[model samples]
Target: MIDEQTRSLLAGIGGFDPTPGALAGVVVVDVTRVVAGPYCAMILADLGATVIKVENPDDPDYTRTFPPLLTGEGSEPLSGFFAQYNRNKLGVTANLRTAEGRELLERLVARTDVLIENFRPGTMERLGVGPDRLREANPRLVYAALSGYGQHGPYRGRPAYDNSAQATGGLWSMNGPAGGPPTRVGTIIGDLAASLYGAIGVLAALRHAERTGEGQLVDISQQDSVVTLTENAVVAYTTEGTVPEPLGNAHPFVRPYELFPCRDGHVFFGGYTDKFWRISCEVFGGEGTADAHADLSDMATRFDPDVYRDRVRPMVEGWFRDRTKAELEALAGDLVPLSAVKDIGEVVDDPQIAARDMIVETEYDGYGALRTFGSPVKLDVTPPRTRGRAPATGAHTAEVLADVLGYSAAEIDAMRQAGAI
Candidate 1:
């Protein structure tokens, strides 16, 4: 839930707080550098957590060097990709491999409620910040571990990215149009999906620990999460002993549930119900059950889906061709389930998204203000609002050491000079 003050502020007609900077109280220690880990920490920061993102100086996040970093008045080595994923985080560089650095992290850990890291199995254990040590340091610390495989199994120690996970999990094999080779999803679906799952697990664990003073390690596998995105391919393989092929945008076993051509773009329409099928037929000026009954009525008849697809395609395509994106979204919302496959620009420019505050803008000191997607979750009393831009590397190192770890300025200066911070 959004806070009373925030809600009241938002309800004041014109606009609420355009730039709600810091989220007070909650603190998070982010031990991750790349996408999935940083994404989880960013979400926590958005939800009022004071996130401290740790980075190894020698091996900085690859994304930091992702080319042509944003330039501006207060912009400090900002990566275009990093900015989007790590909006509200404070970056601090530390050589965790060093004894002093590890001890510094331990001191920070003493004040952290949550820790996020994505590495191969036992990687953290080797680094001395594994769940057990973190728990001992802070008895109620909720640690989230995200990896390619998992904490166990033969491939647990393997490294992977979004493409690898999709291929290993059978999701790639189920992609593309029919007769196409296995292909990874266009977006980093596996990585982001695993992050979302990790976030949920973290919050759930946090709640339990807060209630009973018990903390647990959350194990999120990108491969396992990717497997869930396999859609109906595995079901067809196990149940009917049929190896499914690339289905593109259509359901493998369902008829009329596919994409069709539109005037400007494409429309994804159809559902499981016979009612929508009937309505679809009516939209094409054909009798609901006159010719499409073979695919509609007989469940087993889907074995030869091409026969019904021939008749259904032109019918839905006709309706889509006659309508615009706006018209299609409105009609779909009113009549049946449908969607306009608008591009990224279209999505960001949508008015409805604006009204929902789904698209937001925040001023960055160096880069002015830019609009981007908002968090998906909505809380009435504790809303997750964008709290300014990401901090510069080592920007909050002194402040965090002083405030959380209670280190003296002399000690902080020494740590900086040694390059172990």
Candidate 2:
């Protein structure tokens, strides 16, 4: 159960409701840093898990120094980038290199429902706090490991960043213009996908633990996660002997399903299906255009490379060239299946995004209201929400140690004196 003080703090944050969250009583020990692992823990935290974020005292999460900082009264500037993924977590620091720090971690793990980490494959084991040891201590503990490769693969020990994962996982090879050099994705899709998958795996493991009282390991690989998103690209090569290549913003097998340039900006048109194609023809190609192109009504004919390149592309480009994004967007509907391509600035103010409460603001003690994203998962009874500002380094160390592990003030002080925290 969350203590009253903690609950009050959460309530003060933006987007919190009086109702208890879905994972209210669950305890999570987040021993991860940076994007992938932190993001996974953040998802659980948003769902009301009591996530205790543990960092190494000597070398904290490097993202803590990332740009776009925020400063509160008498506190060092905090990274908005770090805050984006670390909110709603109690922060604590422990120098795991010391025996005292390792002991503290063991105690915390014994009481934790889930433990997530993103260190290299054997880093935890070398520190003597690996899954085998911790899960032995607590039979119902769910241990999740997020890494670039998995725990047992040949490349498991190799270092990887988002671009490295994208490159090695085959996503980069197929991500650019048809004949252009391979390009990295604009966002960290590799890390984000792995984090999402890691969260799902942790949830599934938690359910299993609840039913059988048995703990398990959830090993998520960024490379594997990225490969899963390739969406039939591998199967196409294996089954039909056709290697996939980049098509820029166009769909590999769908015609008129790509972004089109307009007078002011761009709009994505999705006339791939027969029904939507007819609707698009009526809207863009004018009144009798659908009938005039009756011979190309079938997908096979319209989607053929030669036909699309020579006929359909030119016609669609001609239709879009004279129109403005707003003019094209006005025709968007269920039948048309089109929308204006939105930049970040436009997305923040979009009515649909606003209606969904995707943009949320949280107030810090001295820093004014800071806006970040809202939870995508919405449950009527116990909704997931962003419930607080990110903590300062080890801000909740004394509180968590006392409340969670039943440590005395003297013991905490002794450990602090020894530089264990």
Candidate 3:
């Protein structure tokens, strides 16, 4: 039940009631496998596009066979890996090698609004269904290619995964401690970023097609996407002739902006400005502490590397070490930017996360009900939703051919006999 205030807030905004996706009538043919491509298609599916996962019969998505299968007494074991990123989709098999398969794909392309693939650069063209040929068939189709090195580059042919992208894009250099060896981020940021950029490109291209009925290609490379995230490092190298070294958890230009030790674990506090610095000093002690930091009153002096190393950081560390995380949060609630470093368990139970519905429960076909992440993108109207569990391999092949393509039962059986689906 919603309160009066909450009800009123939702009443003014349309699309609050659950409905079909925002991209409802848009048809997407996802020919990509693996994280980046499947992740992008998943976002589109969440937004209400009717996405058909086009897989080859010989090697279906490897994730579909990945380990940690969910099993029950009367159900076929399902791959949790595939289910994670392939939710809310209709699955089909198209051998692309056979003439009948190619014909079927061509027919699907003729009616599709968007087709995405993340195979090697020339794989699609070699398959006789490249962007140029598909666009010729459907003038308003958005052809999106997500690759490791992009369509054309000196390293275009080089194979890459999340690890290689992070290394090649210079993200590995700036991570970890000052003198420590390079570190990979715990999460797969490179792959995830590429998907986000690819999704944005697809949406923008769809808008352009909607207006003029002319479609274009969207090319996104994981290496390039990771490089874009090295904004400060690029600027420093180009403009200042400086090579930045890792400062552990510290910000490059801000003092008191790093993680600090607390009684139980770790906490982060930011008191970069003079006003916050003075208040922080008062909180630490009072007049004595203020006098000690009097020379570091201005922003320039406060952030100076030498001053921060010799004085500010040590003082802050010592002050933080004396207090518990809860104590510091209470004392500096709104006075300074402070946060406790929470683990995964804490994050799951966090009040703010619960309030925002950042984690939601979804029912997997064979796995029963499980908790998965909710969409971070919140549109007061037309919010993204999880349609259902990920489909079984070629689960919709017969259904789609019959209902969507208007094929007769005999035609569907013939195609199956010929191994075209």
Candidate 4:
């Protein structure tokens, strides 16, 4: 564990203090290739759990073909998008279709504490690394699987990605501008949500296994996960027979709760009460306007949004146009519930993000320093660190087998010669 390179990295950062140990002593065998699975593995890796990313030779992270390669060269092999998700771990490739590859995997599993994968339902079972087989190999191994609908459902075997989950999860139904076409969220929300839950399940299962020598299957359904975020939309549908529709930028039940255009960007003013609405009007120059009427039951009462929108829309538009984004934000003195829309650059440079180490640099010679996201989770005792740059495909194959799996140099060369990796 006393790696000179790792120690040097710890020293180069300003607040370097070496830890004699890391959390839980858990090692994750990551068979997750794309977004959700890789993202979950990365979280475990960031939390100081050793994660070994497993990929096949032919389809070694298809994200490498994504635009804006981390190397940023013409037709480079490494994509920035891929690097974004795969950082803080070791990458190894194998031709899993081969018997040698499967044997090698079974051997690796003997020492691995957890296994994570996001394959179509039954893919692992077909490969003989399914939940039952894997548990048979190591009964104490926590196996987490991510799929579209779930391990079993009408849609279990259907193809699914982020958008598919959003549509099926009832999330897309509640998105977009009011009366506009239902829209997908701009972010890969479903994938990220599932990843976060997957990581949580992995650690929880690991804890259980440590306590009782019992490992269980983590069945992650992306569709169900996105619905968790939709909250009352699901409740309203279940309780009131209401199908939630896209309310655009506005909240479904709250009037004047959406963004208004400023001279620069948009300023969002959210006051959930009529008293606050009157106060908002006093500030935004809409005091006695026809649109800014008070229901007395107030803005919080679920009422016809059309009436409120008609009363407040013009006044808000006129006032917002008179001020720049900064001036509008400033007027919310002592916090009048306002925020200006900011782009990614602004988010990256904001003082708060910098203070929290929300960004980290990956060192590569030609790439120099690659700016990527940092861990957001804060631990009081031992916080997460940017361990290292992502490894190239098969770059650590020989090294990992020799060191972690006890393969000889000659054995690795033989595996290489046999096209097993």
Candidate 5:
């Protein structure tokens, strides 16, 4: 348990409000590292779960050394990447190779509502803390495993990273410009999508456990998650016998639904629907242009490849070429869907993002204030939030041992001295 003084200190930090969150009474054992599992656990932590991050004492989570390092005089360098996903969690160390360490993990599982991990399949079984054993110890424990493949697939034993998952999951095949080489996504969507699914599974399992006193494994595969996000590409192939290929900035079936260059920057214009197309004609081309394109107003005609290529595309391109993003937005008003293609800098300072509290600040002791993306899951009464900064390695080992597991100070000291913490 955090002392009052320590709680006060933490509450003083930016984004560390003490309001009780939706998952306030839940405990999560985060036996994860790097992106996928840690991010899933972080989502629970942000919702006010008391998350205990367990790591090996000698060989901690390697992402703790990830880039954008923060260094201060007489202080250890901290990883901004790690901090971005690990905030609002306590830290503990347990080297699962040893009997004492494994026992420590069992104790933690016995007391936790959820235990999440992302090691390659069977790593926990090798460590003697597999889901079967842990769930046997606590029948109501939600065991969530996030991995590149899954726990029981042919590729379960194979090693995979984000790119590997994307490649295998069919995202790479459908992600590049038309007629160009297949390309991996710009971000780690494979891992992130799996994390989201894992979180959803955990919440659902928690609800089941609450009603039935039964817990189950949430097996989330990055490849499977990525496949689900292919946006009808698989169906397009299976039904029509046509392999989906990248269409660059344009929608596969939507004519004139793509990015167009403006006087200042690019803007995405979705004038595919008849209503929006009419609005676009009125705003950009006026009545004369609308009359000229009267036959193209029919959805079937506009969606035809030859019609779009020879007629619709030329006119839409011409309409946007002379206008700025702001002017196009003004013309669009609420009649059409249009948006400027904002870079990261512009997005960071965007008024809509600011108004929605999509950017938030978190303060570290020596690091001052660091801003990161805020939670997209907003709850009215029990809003999810960053409760505090990420903990240093094993920072709360003794506290958690004593407070949650009912361990004495001397026992914790002994475990630390024995290199089992």
Candidate 6:
């Protein structure tokens, strides 16, 4: 059961309470902009943490001005991109350049359990809220910093985005075709990966703080996070002196592990072992089962690139090219591992994803209803829920000032007149 104070807090902020999530009573002060830091804070918010998103009144998060705006008939417009990452948060505008603004932030930090920021290495220190200062105010606050490069390094002060981090961290080199030009990933994986790691670090630090009454800084680098996705690139180079390159859609080690062109679209299938290979031969119905191809039955022979490219893939491609997606599904049944390549529209409308509530409809003040991706981590006991829509710019400014900071109406108006919030 939720406490009356928590229920009133939720009601005052226009937040919903679908289920009691893991971080019900936790408070997060999110002074982050752009994708990485906001995403980390959103993850905590999804788990029922009360996240207060701090934005500068002069220069708000850049995404607030981005395109694809959702507007009501008479209300203001809101950016869909901003709403996607900043959901279930209380938005506040504070001019950090002013003394009053920093005082407000200091007050919020004193009672917050966690704080997330993605500014450059020394930016927080310049704002007079560095780790040392924050620790003095609240020793048990879990402070997290998400950056392109880590806090201490040669490239710490250098600027980097998702593309830069991907290029510097070997993802660009390891992607694309075997001999083709370097290609960027379709999405901002570098920033997103760093956010996930940063969120995990915050959770762990919070647990530590809960037990020992001490908190530490969590520093996550986008470049470092992107490097972890290079499947076995490091091991191949360090152990065998082999620098791996992209093999298109095919696996470097597994044979028949590639995308095949079908009649209408594409399908990816894999069958390496004898049992599955025999099943694959039946479904493919080609020279893959001939006596001349007997040597290819062994996993080693199939693992050979020449054998796979010259003999195996050709047969499979020919078979798949002649069959439709439905026919192949019926023919293969569940014996073989196979799935048709789907586009974004197909994925969004997929029955499996729909059944699992992967896409949900949430309502905002200006935007009546918006469709957004739901949380992937689902716990049986206390599953995370999307309580409410993303807030408008500085929507909870007065409410937060009154409830959290105990600022009277006159004081709030005075600060606003001073251009502090």
lDDT of 1 by residue, 205-306 (tens): 888877887878999999899888777777778998988778788787676677877777787776446666656556544565435454444433432566
Supply the TM-score for candidate 3: 0.90
Candidate 5's residue-wise lDDT over 81-172, tens digit each? 89889999888999999888999999878767899999999999988999999998889999999988999968998888999889999989
Tens-digit lDDT track of model 6 for 1-421: 2235644564467456646688887888899998999999999988888888999988889998677788886355778788889888899989878889988988888777899999989898998888888988888989999999989999999988999899999999878887797788889999999999999999999999989989899999999999999998989999999987866787879888878889989888887777788778865675545454677778888888888879888878877888887788778847788887889798899887898888888876545888878899888887887646777778899988888678999999999999999
Candidate 6: stretches off by over 4 Å: 1-11, 286-293
Candidates in order: C-alpha RMSD to true structure: 5.4, 2.7, 6.4, 4.4, 3.3, 2.4
* True-structure lDDT of candidate 1: 0.73
- Give one digit per residue, the lDDT tens place, for model 4 in 1-421: 2234433332332221234224425667889877999989888777776667888977788886786765544345467777788876677877778777887787667677888999999998898778898788788889999988889979989989999999999899889987899999999899999999998888888889889888899999999899999968877878998998888777767766788888888878776566666667677664564244545335544246666566556656887887898798778634567788889898899777899988887776466667888988888676775646676787667766766667788888888788888
Best by lDDT: 2
Runs of candidate 4 exceeding 4 Å displacement: 1-24, 72-77, 274-282, 285-297, 300-307
> Each prediction's Cα lDDT score?
0.73, 0.86, 0.80, 0.76, 0.85, 0.84
TM-scores of the candidates in the order shown: 0.87, 0.95, 0.90, 0.88, 0.94, 0.94
2 against 4, candidate with superior TM-score: 2
Ranked by TM-score, the better of candidates 2 and 6 is 2
Q: Model 1 TM-score?
A: 0.87
Give a tens-digit lDDT track for model 3, residues 1-421.
1124322332232222236568766778899897899999989878877678989877788887776677765256777767778877778888898887887787778777889999989888888989988888888989999988899989888888888889888888888887798888788888899999989999999999889989999999999999998869999999999987766898889787889998988898898888888888888766678777578788789788999889888888888897888788888867888888889898889888988887777665446775666678777777787535677778787766665666789988888888887
Candidate 1, residue 366: Cα displacement in angstroms equals 2.6
The candidates, ranked best first by lDDT, are 2, 5, 6, 3, 4, 1
> What is the TM-score of candidate 2?
0.95
Write the number of the candidate with greater lDDT, choosing between 2 and 6: 2
